[model samples]
Target: MAIKSFQGARKQQSDTSEDAPFKVSDIMCKDLITFKPEQSVEEVIETLINKKISGGPVVNDNNELIGIISEGDCLKQISESRYYNMPMENDNVEKRMVKDVETIDGNMNVFDAANKFLESKRRRFPIVVNGKLVGQISQKDILKAAISLKGHTWDK
Candidate 1:
């Protein structure tokens, strides 16, 4: 009976640890959508609507992320123009996007990433390695991680 009990405890501990190895990479969205700096805002708006995404990373022809554009940015333009019916021709994404975008490394811990997200008002953040965009970590991802880690204790 003691041996059987020991085996059961071991199984429980293993299961707990398996589910609790929370990492930013584990929760980050790998299937990332991206835009190009040269793309028109109208085109990007269409893509955002069709994809049902808030925003996406902006990459160059060499697939290097230069900036990001969000729904908020689009909305700001509309508000500034007093709801003008003209297409987004004169305005470019590069002009509106946050030039010095903050990024997180993929290998960073989920806790640190979550802290950064909370500290900033930006809805989304790009994940990069060696200055190359690999994926994106959003507020949603951090919330999911936090929920997963709730009421859980880890061994040192």
Candidate 2:
């Protein structure tokens, strides 16, 4: 009886999912859909919805991420227009894109990335290397890492 209880206690102390190791690049979305700063807000919204993405990075001719545009930002403009009965004309991405964008390094561990996700309201973070956009990581991506790491059982 004591041995059975000891075995059960040992099983309860087994390593949890958080004990596993993974990297940001492990689960980051590589096929990124990006937009240009000069793009009109209308076009931005169209691309975002069509792509089924919540947001994307705004890159320039040099492949540098200048800002990030999201559905939330576009909706704010749209909501305001409806409230004031104004026209949604001449709205550019540069005008609404967030200039102070937060980026993450591709090599960073998933643990730190998860913490960052919990710390901010932003759903996604642009992955950068040498100051150039490479990919994008989202909260879902981190969750993917957690599931993939923990759900796989190693037949030891």
- For each predicted model, how many residue pairs clash, with residues at least 3 apart or on different chains? 0, 0
Candidate 2 regions with alpha-carbon error over 4 angstroms: 1-21, 83-85, 151-156
Across 80-121, the per-residue lDDT of candidate 1 in tens digits comes to 666776556777788767678888877778878778877887
- Score residue 114 of candidate 1 by CA lDDT: 71
Cα RMSD to the true fold for all candidates = 5.0, 5.0
Model 2 TM-score relative to the real fold: 0.80
Candidate achieving the largest TM-score: 2
Candidate 1 residue pairs in clash (backbone atoms < 3 Å): none
Q: Which residue pairs come into collision in candidate 2?
A: none
Lowest lDDT sum, 10 consecutive residues, model 1, at 4-13
